[model samples]
Target chain A: MHIIIVGCGRVGAQLAQILSSEGHNVVIVDKNQESFKRLGADFNGITITGVGFDPDILKRAGIERADALAAVTNGDNSNIMVSQIAKRIYNVPRVLTRIYDPLRADIYKKFGLNTIGTTTLVAHIFRSALLKESAKHEFTIGNDIGLVEYRVEEEETAAKESGGGKK
Target chain B: MYVLIVGGGKVGYSLARRLADEGFDASLVEKEERMAKRIAEDLEQVLVIAGDGCDPGRLEDAGIARAQVVAAVTGDDEDNLIICQLARDTFGVPRVIARVNNPSNEITFKKLGIDTVSSTTIISKLIEEEATIGDIFTLLALKRGKLSIVELIIGPKAPAADKMIKELRLPADSILATIVRESHIIFAKGETVLKPGDSIIALATTDSEMALREALLGKE
Candidate 1:
């Protein structure tokens, strides 16, 4: 499997190294040349320095033939843009995006995007560990399915914030 | 209407100035302290807020709840999108406009129900318009085939050059409407002479288009 990663942060670099070591093709993209240092001198995966979401850059990074794409950029918007391009434009079968803001992450999920939020995950885990009953979860679909649900007033907050204007 | 603008870059600064000049309530937010300060040098400080637009605290202080139109024109497409979404989802701003740096993201922005101003699309269109005049240009087309307005330049080697419009055997259905020579508009008439380096705008039918071209260049 060929995987394309859009960031050169720790997670992105480590993921690329691991995936390449596992015998899967890996291509890592970063705008700054310095970020490639994270992948280490022994890394074998391809490293591309350019705007991650640029069509030309993605093409050079093998996005057209990539089996999966992970947008782990620091900015929620950048990650979302990269993910959307990978999904809607290239039709990558597997696309994942990382969002820092939990609210914004939830909103994108409503639009049918696979997203992960670091702050959301950490806070939920912290709460579950500290207080079992204080955990933010709803009933699971079945005993075998562990569905994680957070009690966020997304709909009401959205309607209220629109200040009774056009929904 | 009250307008809240994020990103005090060229677009935001110019738009705020124009809006202020037009007597509308406008405020601008810039994440960079230097940018906000520089913009505040010309505009009122009250109208310029130095803070991250994505932060709800900053948005509330910038009066996002009262913003009728929110335009995020930052350089980063993602930042602009997040700012607009925050304004809409957090404060319920009625109208949210986001600037899209990538043309491919325009469809995604639209699909997510966000109105986007795509700089890539605008730039591409401008380039396309400029290159259209490089060769044969179709100005207008009437119906499906009745008439087509075309513009072409007369080269020095063309046979029609240095000839009077009256002498040229232009088809009955084809008429030379105007001639542009060195930035001057010359109404084409029978006695008007054609010269090299002249842009001719003509109205011709589909069947006569080839004949018009052949007559103008003296070639089939």
Candidate 2:
């Protein structure tokens, strides 16, 4: 599949490498030519130095035939704008964007764009690993619905033993 | 298979409802009579019983011995722990999952041989971190924040495409762990050439998500 990645930052670069290694056509767009230097001498994909949201830049990145688009730039607005263009104008089958603010996640979701919040995902990791004794408040299964996993600990015992069962 | 969930709170109700929707044999035991009645009214197939989840008698009454997996998701951490222990030790349920409200209590639960989830703490932290850090995929956290698993999908315009995995001078702190293509998962190797549509899973420090992404997808 042909994939276009806007933003040459950490997420975009890594995503490009992953897809490239998997044997798919990949193109990366960025504003700075120096950013491509980070990919090193052996890197093997097309790198376009231009604003990701610019239509001309996208066309140069082969957005017309792209199957998917990922907007993971540092700025949320830029990511959203690029993703919208990719989905609406370019007609990419799949479009994903990195949303820094969790509050805006719902707004993006309503537009049918897949959003991933870096902070929320990370915090969940830390909390799960660090806080294991407190009463679990919520658990989710799959992306939509599946088996939600949770941990049972001491506070739960006190609630059951002292709180008394169903009065 | 009869799935017994101990707790009638949001998690329990949601689980019961979802399982029921999937055509599973699900039941809930809520110690509070009112909560039990409410859950019973809300669910069509779930059998809601008001009883102490930790009590062996209550579990037996809920047919714990015949349950495929006993989930303890009561609001209280202690109650969940006891229910899980009893389910494993006394009732002999094959699978038991407990909810941990406090993130700090995870180790104790693990030592007790029960799976635990600090969903609230973790989810809140996730939201907080996303608000602060701005970029990078957290992937899966491990060792209480000491490690993480992140993924970055190669983009069409990236510089690393068409090059062998060994050719790219990846940072020392990061390692390309797996390559996903067309839903097929492959281990990363030196001879492997990165292509478009490939998803790369890597293990690195929390701060490295952005760097990894830049390395794999950033443009010139």
Candidate 3:
């Protein structure tokens, strides 16, 4: 899939690197030139420096042919605006935006936007891990389906996921 | 009527003050604390909230759901567009008015169902009006300037004064419509005598304007 990821923050950078490694065409756009440093030296993808929502800049970033777009900019308004432009103006099929504010994220969803709220997602993960006994899955699709343990007090969730060999 | 205005710039501030003066329940949301405080101090009757107007929480706090009309008059076009969209589509505000800073964005705002007031277009029109202001005010210039209705404020030195319409040699295709005096409007006829300080309304074609101006004011 050809993807245009706006913002070169941690999530954007990691997503670009992984998607590019998987042989998908990835283009990362950021207003700051220093953000490209997060992608490392060997990663091959286009980098654009301009406001993400600018129609001309987006066109230059291959928005016309892009299959997906992810707006992960720190500003919620910027992310929402860019996502709306991609979806409504350019008719991009797949559009996603990361909104940090939970309430604003819900509003975006109500407005028919696809929003990923890392704050709420991480907060849920922490609450579920701390409760331990409250996360009762009502149904399981397959025997391999397992909810990996996340340590709320420790940084062991990443290690725990790899250590579990359910697959 | 309840009105919620986004952005506390000069436009929003004056609008809020005027609406409050008219006894409307008006509220203004300003992103800057200092501006919000200053506007709050100046507008005794309007509700002022200090926060980003684009934020849904702040808008809700400012009573967006109950607002009969929402005006997004921020200097920024993008911010204005989003605020109006959110107010209309999300909250179902009955009326939404957006101030479009860029004339090019007016069409986009209209297509999105938000009514826009483009100051750029209005300012351009004002500049056009200033350049054309004279004794002969071309009210309606039509069809590539072929036909027009021009009004002239006749002064005491005007040579057309005390002259009957039929006696004066008005150019062909030009006709007098009305003589607007200080107190009344006189529908001009062939025998009507033009007087000093008479505001003359004439309908003429493009080529006849010079002749009409010369006949009324005596010269260029």
Candidate with the greatest lDDT versus the true structure: 3
Tens digits of per-residue lDDT for model 2 on B49-125?
89877666778888888998999998866567657866886667889999987665465466546898789777888
Candidate 3: Cα lDDT at A90: 74
Residue B30 CA displacement from its true place in model 2, Å: 0.8
Model 2 per-residue lDDT at A127:
67
Off by over 4 Å in 2: A1-167, B125-149, B153-167, B172-174, B177-220
lDDT at B82 for candidate 3? Answer: 77
**Which is the leading candidate under TM-score?**
3
Model 2 interface CAPRI class: incorrect
DockQ score of the complex predicted as candidate 2: 0.01
The TM-scores, chain A only, for the candidates as listed are: 0.78, 0.79, 0.81
Interface RMSD per candidate (angstroms): 3.6, 22.9, 2.5
B70: Cα error in model 1, Å: 4.0
lDDT score, candidate 3, position A97: 81
Chain B TM-score list for all models: 0.60, 0.72, 0.67
Q: Is the docking of candidate 3 incorrect, acceptable, medium or high quality?
A: incorrect
Calculate candidate 1's fnat. Answer: 0.29
TM-score for chain A, prediction 3:
0.81
How far is A69's C-alpha from truth in model 3 (Å)?
A: 0.7
Q: What is the TM-score of chain A in candidate 1?
A: 0.78
